[model samples]
Target: MKTDSRWITTPITADLLRGALDLERTEHGVLPHRLPARARAQCGDPQLAMVESQPSGVRLVFRTRATAVELDTLPTKRLYVGAPARPDGVYDLLVDGTLAGQGSVSGGTVQVVDMSTGSMELRPGPVGTLRFTGLPGRDKTVEIWLPHNETTELAELRTDAPLTVAPDPGRKVWLHHGSSISHGSDAASPTAIWPALAAALAGVELVNLGLGGSALLDPFTARAVRDTPADLISLKLGINVVNADLMRLRAFGPAVHGFLDTVREGHPTTPLLVVSPILCPMHEDTPGPTAMDLSALGAGRITFVATGDPAERASGKLTLNVVRDELSRIVAQRAAEDPHLHYLDGRALYGEADAAELPLPDGLHPDAATHRRIGERFAELAFADDGAFAGSGGERRAGGR
Candidate 1:
């Protein structure tokens, strides 16, 4: 019955949400005034796609019917939005027509925390719209974050500020792929996601394809990478495929080539880096498809754990070493003809030594702090030379450090 309690949808989609723009209405459906090439083809699931970047002005518009009363003080109960960059994450609250609020966002120092501590608190990230929770009676100014994906940028305006957001100008587009860790499982903020932080450090942009619970070398994802535009690209592989038992030695070889082949079509010759998995004890050396960890979620707990044998991991069945070895072979053979391809031992960024100090907080994803460390290492290794990859080979990549 109320604006906040209801929402309307139109048929419009794009690859990756990019740039800033105004919303437009079309006979076919609602369309964004402008969409970047890369963002034009992301997230095949249109069910939850944003109308545009920030919903193409109103991508995920939500409001509340709660009568206005001035916020005598900060509200206690709050909302949380995790994986802000992920398309399926549709958890934004808008007030009036402007973006009055946002989900919890993290900066370089702060971690996104929800009132529950384990969750992220959704609140105003930028100030294009105004959210009226209990503020109907007062003539007061409420603070709002800029409507667009803003970080390291700042400005201030009253609720009357025109609803125009400057597109992210520090765009350095880094395309990253990996397991849950890369999907931002434990990172502190939406923007603080490792790829994002690394991009920030290098003054580049990002196109993160880190799929949670599903980075098992899906061909569609490979095509996604092939079609997307990126200044830099990195694929953090291994753990997921090994744990998922997605492929065996015979099939894995060709699959890797196919994935690369698809990417090469679009990238042609970008700074492509292949990264192996970090340390995980359970599946380290085991050949899976393993089980899930569903102990705490009511009845579904037991089914989550993988049933694969641990011996396989300890012996030859499963191991980061095996994955790394084969992966190296793949890259080596590929590099013979292509000079731009590079490889980095996942550990070097956060190898065994660092892992010892920073054990996996969740047995998989790194903690917020580790994400920061990883981001820095990636920047150093990625940009340490003349824009080339800083790998164990000690060879400078085509791009400068």
Candidate 2:
């Protein structure tokens, strides 16, 4: 804790947060969670537990006249045992809804995972501070977007001026769910993630439920989405399912239906969009159980390779193409009775041509440039005049310019 008398310390609370469904009071401070406690209690998956705590679209929003601000955070960074070190997660500061500055914290806890053996080891580290100074002193809305890929615990918030929770701008809330790509894998920062970028471009409040390696249409996740308040909803399905090889085609269809049913229970007429997987050559026609490219491991690079047999499609195996076909058919069939239900072929956002231009460096997640491209494309497609999310009363351009 800083002893500077000029700094005003404010206790972090739920009213200062956006995009997180729940907040867990930690030993140091509150930790934001994308999923509620009831949903977390149902699943014992370690992957879900970690990713949901990563605060994809979560941020601290308030109105203040502060010219200087400091946030104390304890971040848990993930590392693959033999792979190259991951970069430090970034914190983006926005003033009056426009990006103003960016900073990062250092010396936090580390979690090292051995991909081949599925083993994880933790290393303790100290908390770090992120500070921004010399802002315009006039009263303005300020947002501190946390890292999308790092599990962070908020310790304290201090500013040179008094701060109050910002009133809601009354934007329609968009609740989205998907895999790691949507969870912000390989993106530059929190606000640079595709969902965040798209929400900014489309002018809506984002509630990201994009769990990495865990968007397998789990009932608990569906229930969480069902309970959250939202005017628009989207599910980016299939990649995690195919890569995890969690189920067969027989189970995939029913799982998709069940997930939608759960969400519709609470939001029956909400414009719901079902998005199929984008083009990943490794899993496009080939079934997965994607594996680490062990050969690259020696070079300290991490890449993925599909291990499932292409012949397994005969046994009801699910592939990207298979999932896309199934999703289109399912959405069309359901749309007859539910006019608000919509389907988007994920390739529209990133097709083979785009993949050829900006290949997935990991054979899975998109690069930062690709993330920007996807976000821009998604906004155009989903928020356009004739798009499914259009005319939902919250489709303004970036900064409402």
Candidate 3:
């Protein structure tokens, strides 16, 4: 057997990972989780369990002079039967704080779930390798951001030279929570997720708690955010609640209050931003327990349609318009006493005009281009001078001006 004598392999451990709250060592490798063990134990929903384990803002960071790097991963890919196949998850390689390369590993196991029948099937596949060669010859910091939509198990890291853990950049950490939009739905790559993009634009570290179909105002999630250390915090509320039909007006207002209260208990003076949902034409005036359009699915496309009646709003059902109004009022009332608490109408990021030009392809989540637009807009609105989170110990450029 021909053996390469110059390769050095390092076991991926918690020390090499950032933006992850916990790591679970598995038989094959280490799995990074966004939620701590205690918080994970409090939830019994399988959906939540799955999503919390999907690394959204997690990255493997180290310093090396290696010209070649290889990462072995075992990823659990999801597939929905009778629907369009999803794209392969992408891994982004950043060298010296610049995006240097992008790659994807194939051959991971697939979990096919039939949403109509509620049955799932597991199809085992081989592990795959992601390799990037011809990096700069000098010592430099390297960050490998994992896929946001897939559950990745990091098995081994191999390089041509010795590696050391990268020193923290001392940037302010921004912890954010939202639904699938924040979870990178339709995003092109791991770093393209809106929160990641916004974090880059804002020059802050991101800790994203964006669970798909699972942001139900759960106490554990609020507690998770409460316990995490952060210089800036933002919560994108309302869309998930409205779409999931998780609660009525009566419970939503109080639940929001409780969530904020819990966060405030841990961070009384921290800069906290509360954002409502963007304009979703389907659910703007109508309440929803959003359902799939079967006809569209049969036509080889997927579409979501609001099922609840608009008249239900009169009986206290929640809608996007209702949620936005209520959220604005709540933040305004509290901001008088809490100077650091701030609010941004989500429409400022994406409104009816933007929707007309660039519609949500699925009638819910924004596409990749929209993600870019939102990220850029957020940086301007929330991270600029005199903005809600501006100069709150976050990174700034030049001249103290």
Candidate 4:
């Protein structure tokens, strides 16, 4: 590609970012984080640490007449030591709210994990550039949705024309937190994640806090939600808790209460939706500490199995079914005092029949097709004309201060 002498390079700063909670300056450039530093410091869980920095819903928003743009990034890609290979994460470019192009960058550092051995190793690599050309000639708003699954470090940004911060979409912002299912673990790209898809369909802004393996009803996470501005909120609970066996039925209800109470402090009347876990037969009735199916991994495939016994449920161990029932009951009890609060069975988004049609490929996360299905189903059930979250778009506010 030929560079024009008039091309300009702009420093990528927070002013040009959206949907991110924090940005950390680095030697290479800047790294986006879904969790702020204070909230991140409150947790020591490695899984939480990793996912919060992955930027699941973060993007760069700006306006320019540039017909060509380039972003230098160093992506930290993950690789399971014994599992099959995965492709590079994709970068999606949207012009005037429409997807104009998509591409992926390679040659990034690799974080290799050997689940069998419970060990991790880092392999350093070089940075790569992602380039998009043929953008419209006139100035237009642009959104560069980051990869949902990769940890990316933005090094620099270049364009053929001067750039300025784009105005906000002037829509309601929906803040959602969930497990890997909502993190686009299996989705094709960042914008394809269920929350992103649902937000776009409902014509609202999104602040996805869908940390993979980390939506454990933590107080700090609750506080983060409380501080953030949102017109609507949703919590997709149960899967991570059940799989990790983090808490039993004895403590689950109170945790849920505490989480909701904190958020209510910030947005008492926001349309809050409590969503239970989607269908996962492995942990449906059986308790879990979901274990990797090593036999499957050895065959160049990956799968999971519930390791907890059904008998444990009688001991107050929480299974998906138990959690779902509890969540429904809790919502009903609270709705008496807070009519704005509502509940939706995760199964409604991906129930038994839907699972039968598109079985979970890994017996855990939904596949790409299922991501699309869930996104569409969620939009229909929650954002439709008569839905619980109907008319929930954040009231339009004046653009710019």
Candidate 5:
């Protein structure tokens, strides 16, 4: 539906956005970026460029009395050449911190990628709008969470009534970094992602840096984490290293230590937690460079298989089990000097037993239900009375420079 001219139009400003590090003005409108321009410029990888702009944990937040709201966006939806059609990305609206409504815009830009060969083609489409109606017409907080996997360019925001920047609720800020799993892979919606859900449950503000296929302990990423402000920090490592086959055992340990050292430069006393990879049977004992299961692909399903031999471990190839053991030792050795530093086995969030009941649909990322389970488990483990993030008593700090 065309937006009513009488509806109030508001400028999409930085103050109204959360979880994004930078905002780039585009020909259409503003694009929220998880990585800063400097960090982005330093790397030439298209994967990082794409995922950082997906706005995994980013959202528009404010105080409004509008009963109806509309957001105009140009979303770049990804399509695999031979894979089944994927659903449109979801937009979740919250009123006073509770899920009130959901919407999705159709007819945006489409990016077709070939999995077998690393090639991409972009097809531009018209801008679409997401509309949410019947919100409570009283002074209340409103949050419109962008899609976790879609690259969205904000064009306009329309509301039946005026809105203002919402006041901070004095919650502690939690900054977390991880892989695609933490980035909301296969999760139902943006807010339903584990980090977002855990943050809501723990009553803390969140700045998620869960870049898909690009959390490989890069100096720029470590610098990004070093620069971002937060009361608590957590790093979920190992799976990406194992699956990407990015490095050997000798390089993995030093890379992790260096990454932590960079983060500590800015937040020396902040509660920092290091988490290992969860149970992934494919990569647990077997090494990888995981490959797409071509047999399943022909049947319109996407699945992955580890290609590296288990014997490669003797030659320094990294596996999930090897990564986990190394991470445990590294954290334990570092904790004696850094009291705020802590370690949690990632299996505690999603373990062997949980996998048997709810196996990974793609042999990798969890399904929607498992995302919820992980989020709930994370909240229980990280925010409990004696949890790693416990006793963080202070007003939430503002994130983003």
Candidate 6:
């Protein structure tokens, strides 16, 4: 039996973990991975902070095939823990309720923070270890919850508890990558991130690798996606690469081809959706800005500017439109030969229609409501039952960088 097989066994009981907090019943003494907030509330655990916003112990939890697990397999599954409500610059992680992984952050760091319990501390943000564990037998579903943000998890149940469920197994898996916008920008809750929301609406499993500022088409990233196990996949490209003005046309074109080529190498016929960036008026046609400018918002500090006229948007000179055009053209050409390959224009996902009414809060990244709308549109277009993508696993599972 492979370590990370998608044959998940859930309806897991709280007795699986011996932690401080007692888990409330998920369908009574069991919790599945797709525990929605409402379900969590009903189960009494809430599953809220357990995802991202919650502290170290429960930020996120996953079932592992590790008996005495050695970390990593295939594409690598890493946990990204962010700074918590109280920044200690250090935090500890307990796997199966024992101190395991650890990293630390500096005090008062603005963008990201860290947490510490015992000697272990977790990484602040954007990056962290890609981990794997082995929990053998029909038992699946590990528990996660931070001590401070601690809510009850199924693991807190009594030992020798009854197996809540065996397996039904119909859910598909989703693979996605993008920028900070996709990572979860202004969303109020961690679970409310567009991808999370989309996953809920679609009823599929998800593996999200949306690095905030790091979706630069690195070969490593492409390789990561290619080798991982997924029923369906999508890449929300262009925006961040353009906003950062990170690469030029000469390199961008080849990068897109190479990125797809790498993935096709592994999952050649798997449903692959390559989506271009959504609209951003400022840098749509303009080369994005090089130096940070803050006068627009009238703020003192100058951060990266995402919008401006085509010529003046950036000194380094890459625009959102240029990247999106290049990306779409590449995907379209590929689709001609590969029936499984598909292209979704970002605008089709979220376009001028939306911009007219729901302007982006900061001229970049959508607010929560916009995220919902984008999710809805994506679900409508990509998973329209009769669409080419009906088999593509499109249940509002797309957002931008």
Candidate-wise lDDT, in order: 0.51, 0.92, 0.88, 0.90, 0.92, 0.52
Error of 4 at 203 (Å): 0.3
Q: Which sections of candidate 3 miss by over 4 Å?
A: 1-3, 393-401
Off by over 4 Å in 4: 1-4, 393-401
lDDT by residue for model 4 (262-324), tens:
999988999999999999999999998998899998988889999999999999998999999
Candidates in descending lDDT order: 2, 5, 4, 3, 6, 1
Go through the candidates in order and give the C-alpha RMSD of each one to the true structure: 11.5, 2.7, 3.2, 1.9, 1.3, 13.8
When summed lDDT is taken over every stretch of 10 residues in candidate 4, the lowest stretch is 392-401
- Please name the candidate that would achieve the greatest TM-score relative to the true structure: 5
lDDT of 2: 0.92
Clashes of 6: 31
Per-residue lDDT of candidate 1, residues 100-170 (tens digit): 44443332112243322344433433212223344343232222222222221111112211122323343
lDDT of 3 by residue, 1-401 (tens): 11367889987877788879889988778999998899888988777877888898899999999999999898889997778888888999999889999998898889897777778788988778999998999999999999999899888899999999887777778889898898888899989999999999888888898888877788888888888888888999999898889899999999999999999888788899999988899999999899877778777777899999999999899999999999999999999999999999999999999999999998998999999999998999999898999777634322110
Clashes of each: 67, 0, 0, 1, 0, 31
TM-score of each: 0.60, 0.97, 0.96, 0.97, 0.98, 0.59
Give the per-residue lDDT digits (tens) of candidate 2, residues 1-401: 99999999999998999989899998889999999999899988898999999999999999999999999999999999878899899999999999999999999999999987899989999989999999999999999999999999999999999999898787888889999999999999999999999999998889899999999999999998888878899999999999999999999999999999999998898899999999999998899898889889868999999999999999999899999999999999899999899999999999999988999998999999999999999999999999999886644322210
lDDT of each residue in 1-401, candidate 6, tens digit only: 12344333343333333211223343223322222233334432211223322221123344443333221101111221232243222233445434454433222112222112212233322212222334344444433322221121222211122233213234676667776656655554444567656765776655565555556786766776776667778898877676566777878899889999998998888788888878877667767543334353234322345444565534435687667767778877888899888888888867898899988776777878887877677667666786435756433322110
The lowest-lDDT stretch of 10 consecutive residues in candidate 6 is: 71-80
Give the Å error, residue 334, model 4.
Answer: 0.8
